[model samples]
Target: MRYSASHKLETREKLLQSSAVSAKRSGFSTVGVDGLMKAIGLSGGAFYSHFSSKDELFASVVESELRQSLERLGAEQDRDKLERCLKQYLSMCHVEHPETGCALPALGAEIARSDIAIRQQAEHWICQLQESWAQVLESDSLAWAILSQCIGALVVARMLATTELQHKVLKSSYDEIGRQIAGPGA
Candidate 1:
């Protein structure tokens, strides 16, 4: 019994979505192909039907996650909207919910450790996101600075043991970014 093309596509989508969430919540390198397949209600053997290897699936996951991030954060055409987006990104909710939030802070280290091809794929999406912001902010450097700060803030906040410290990290980053955006020609 052969599956139809649509069935194959749907199954692939499900696998990608489940694997991405798992990777963000846990870590991509830590989870094996069997586990990823299990998350999508399939056996390990079914994974190769969608992707050649775990590395391929990871590349796909990184691309999918970063593309979604670009869609969410890159669409803001004005400073106010961008600030709101950043605020949400740096919130405690995002810190506590890695599976549902941006993949950067969650998987940055893993991406860095990945092979060159995956790193290049991540770089492409990240650059697209920065370019979108640069258009709105009219400064490439400022866009890069804010992007780095937001991701770093989330990573740092998540590492802290107490909610108070987490909040302090988030609020400080947001407040400083606000000042930077308000200064000079910004």
Candidate 2:
């Protein structure tokens, strides 16, 4: 019995989707092939048919996750996009829900230590993300600053033990970013 090419593509997409969730929810480095296969109801033996290696999956996951982050952060949305996107991203809801959130806060450092190929792929998406933000925010400097701050704030908020502190980090960063982007005296 052989699967059609479209079926194979569908299965591969399923695996990528599940892997993206697992990578964002847990560390990408922490999820094994068996676990990822189990997630899509496929046997571990079927894993190789989709991805050549875990490193390959890591790169794909990074690409998929960053694409999502770009969309969620209002990649090509209108002028009010930044503020609206930040309101969602810097909320406690996002902090508590890692599965549906941006991958950067959860796995940026981990991916930074990945193989050169994966790191290069990540750098491409990172620049793409910056470009997306730059489109709406106008200045490359402002785009980089906001993206760095958002990633840092979420990472710190996720690390802390208390919800209060987490919300504080989120709110403070949110307000500060809004002010900075709003320009002087804003």
Candidate 3:
């Protein structure tokens, strides 16, 4: 049965969204076209009708994930609210739920090893994130530091052996960084 163009587009989008969640929970390379299509209730053969190749689908998925992350962070230009946002971002919930969390912390390594198109998309997203953060920071250095710390902390927390260790890593990193940013004066 032939589907309308709009229906085809919608199905393709659904597949991309599903693939993004799966990629985040597992790894991008591990998400097969067949599994992605099945998750979206479509036949695997239709995958190529939507995407030219797995790489194309991957690039689209990365773009979608990055957009979602930016929206999740809300207004990044307010310094007073940024720390609270960061704390929430690096919390245990974020660590335990990769599918619903930031793609950077969940799939940074995979993105780094991806094709040029994917890497370019990731780089653009990182720059945009950094710029948003910089607007809320006292200096560029602080913005860079905060961004790096948040990503690093989340990655490390996700890699720990136990939930206790993950919580400890997140708490320590959050508290120390928060204190440093707040300073003794404020």
Candidate 4:
């Protein structure tokens, strides 16, 4: 029996959400199309109905995840409490839950080498994220630096084997970011 359009759309959304978590937990390059479809309670063949290839699925996942993260980051923004928002970005919760956290630290390196289309998509979202921060801080340079540091700190922290080291990495970056956000002038 043929599924209705609404059913197909719902199924596609389910696949995209599950795919995002899978890709975030395991790098996009390592997430197989078959396994992803299976994890979402669909046959491996069903994946082809929604996405042409793993690359296509990956692009969708990246776009979905990045958009979700951007909205979250924007919600955290309080012009008078910028550090609080930045703090959320660097929190231990985000560090421990890569599956639902920002895509930059989890997939940035992989996207850097992906096709031009994927890179452009990532760059667009990154710019949006930066623009949100810039609007709150009123300094494009600081916004870029703070966003860069947050991504870098999370990447380094996740790479380390020791929890102590991870905390240290996050702490150092957080302290410095806070300091920079609230300069002597503030």
Return the top candidate by lDDT.
1
Which ten-residue region of model 3 has the weakest summed lDDT?
71-80
Candidate 1 worst ten-residue window by lDDT: 75-84
Q: For all candidates, what are the clash counts? A: 0, 0, 0, 0
The residue pairs in collision within model 4 are: none
Per-residue lDDT over 87-183 for candidate 3, one digit per residue giving the tens place of the 0 to 100 score: 8887999998989889888788888888888899888877777777777665677767878888899999888879999998899888877876786
Better of 3 and 4 by lDDT: 4
Regions of model 4 farther than 4 Å from truth: none
For each of the candidates, the C-alpha root-mean-square deviation to the true structure, in angstroms, is 1.3, 1.4, 1.6, 1.6
Q: Is candidate 1 or candidate 2 better by lDDT?
A: 1
- State how far residue 52 of model 3 sits from its true place (Å): 0.6
| 30-62: candidate 4 lDDT, tens digit per residue | 867788888889889888888889888888888
lDDT of 4: 0.85
Candidate 1, residues 56-162, lDDT tens digits: the string is 99999999999999899997568888988988998999999999999999999999999999999999999999998999888999999999999999999999999
Model 3: how far residue 158 lies from native, Å: 1.3
C-alpha-based local distance difference test score of model 1: 0.93
Candidate 4 displacement at residue 28 in angstroms: 1.2
TM per candidate comes to 0.97, 0.94, 0.92, 0.94
lDDT of each: 0.93, 0.87, 0.83, 0.85
Worst 10 residues of 2 by lDDT: 70-79
User: Residue-wise lDDT of candidate 2 within 1-186, one digit each (tens)?
Assistant: 999999999999999999988887888778789999999998999999988998888888888888777667746666586788888989998899888899888888888898888888878888988888888878899989999999899999999999999999999999999888888876
Candidate 3: count of backbone clashes, pairs at least 3 residues apart or interchain: 0
